[model samples]
Target: MTDSFLTISGFRKTFGSIVAVEDVSLNIPKGEFLTFLGPSGSGKSTTLYAVAGFDDPSAGDISIDGRSILATPPHKRNIGMVFQRYTLFPHLPVGENIAFPLRVRGHSAADIAKTVKAMLSLVRLEGFEDRLPAQLSGGQQQRVALARALAYDPPVLLMDEPLSALDKKLREEIQVEIRRIHQETGVTILYVTHDQEEALRLSDRIAVFNHGRIEQVGSGEDLYARPATRFVAGFIGDSNFLKVREVERRGSAASAILPDGTRIENIPAHAGNGHAATPELMVRPQSLKFVQGSGAGLAVKVKDVTFLGDTSSVLLETGWGQEIWLRGAGSAVKTNALSGPLHVEWNPADSHLFC
Candidate 1:
């Protein structure tokens, strides 16, 4: 059995009339990096708050290593937290800021010194110890906040879009730094972010939340390769959805009739995302091929073509009036050549059902 460092079962939270998180359950393996990914009002941050003890649950239990911590105060929970903004003291130096948590915990001066030194090394902020928050760069100050969070040696780390304020390049850099720190320390990390790329790039597992509930929980590959529902399929990545016009079942194999009178045989997408809302099947741009043969491919009229230097994206309108997006790499294909007639073909397995 995998050892769960944190297990949240049926955890719920409500703010007056609004339900922020409802009966969400998940098991986070020890030392594994888990991320809560969803858009705003989807309850990703609310779940993190429940785990951090900032908001007590309206129902259910939050256990760390098989013991309940629902009653534990925020300070007593021993969690490391990095918020969206760098919450460092403006008047204090970097060293003093990182030492604040240790000071609060009543550590000896010598012990604080040792822990601070180790944390600085871990976050690669060793030399910036003397610099004040205003003196250091944005990335450096962010690293100081991360170092401070780690100073207490908390087993679990909670990050709520810590790098959201930085530019893309700096954000990527700090993301790598955080990954390195996690690998080096083997601490259980619970990250929350609305950025899909960040979740895909950082987590051992990505739990997609929707409307105050967990929609799906699995590795990045699991989400992209096999999304549990249409919400997850549409939210986790870029996908083109086409509604299922009809479905024909035969034994274990099934077929779905598409909008263009095309049938996809022996595919699970025929039923859509199992018992949930019947949505259209998603056809990824990368999974499509421009073919010239007798197949069940949808015929389309190329409306526009964009040159992306290395790659090109084609926008088209199908005979069924559905817009199709295709991505490929070649001599930037002109829109004029593809304007008259175009067909999109792919393997049946590439279709992700939305029903």
Candidate 2:
């Protein structure tokens, strides 16, 4: 892409028999907040370590601005890193913690002071410079760690589940702070996390990993709206699945018949060549709507409805034990209008037919 500045190509790592990363390739644009999002043991952290020079790749290369940096050591890589735990020195003051990187890089005392001051402001920890990291809140400590990383003015930054230690509200506040800082400084960032909402909220693009290989790499909308595989469809979020009893590949648009004899027309399924024939249909609960229609969609009985404030979820089932989920406003399902045999219609664009 035109925005690409840091390109990681064909990077792989193995621990004896187990592979941590396999042919991981992605272009991280300069000034973009890119996130490696996946579950635990999925190699997101390992990949971050590889890029930061903590873990060398068994194969492939990591390059910045089209030049390979695979041989560069962590301290010399000009990449700042903030770990999940605040790895700060106990004896050093918060200001000293931020200035240590600069001091080691041969910056004079005056330069270090100036740099540390600016860095402290960047993380909004200017006033607490004299205090120790242990004296601060979890959020404050994390901010100090961030300030320390950015103190040396590294061109690239790496973060590994940095806010996992904080509470949800604080984590969210720090997330927004991180996003704003990235925007203001235009530093290239490679953030690692397992939270889908965090990835969707803070990333320029998210690389989803599974079994050490990239399941799909795309914008949040791309991955969420148009997932590439069943793993992605089910993993990133919830989906109501139905077995494909019959397949009718009609040109670009294909239709699959569910076990309930309900025919759902899908918006052109891309050929899944290597996958086994585990026939299924995946659709977001929001796709299915309880509307007034006949001989269209599926006939389902509302088994339960859950209120989630913004959107209400309705769980339904077919006579033959197939399940369906519908999403709407919380107040919409109070009436008994949708409890009985109701028509559950989903747009062809919303459903994906997999065979």
Which 10-residue span in candidate 1 carries the lowest summed lDDT? 268-277
Candidate 2 local lDDT, 141-204, one digit each (tens): 8889888888877889999999999899999999999999998888889999999999989999
lDDT of 2 at 178: 96
Q: How does each model score on lDDT?
A: 0.84, 0.84
Which candidate number would show the highest TM-score if scored against the true structure? 2
lDDT of 1 by residue, 1-355 (tens): 4877799998888999998887799999899999999989888898899999989889999899999998899999999999998789999898889999989878999998888888888887777778889988888888999988888889899999998989999999989998989999888999999999999999999999888888889999988887877788888777888777876766534678878787777665533364555557787876777777545487777877888888788877877888878888857355556745767777777766555
Residue 260 local lDDT, model 2? 69
Off by over 4 Å in 1: 250-253, 270-278, 294-296, 331-339
lDDT of 1 at 20: 87
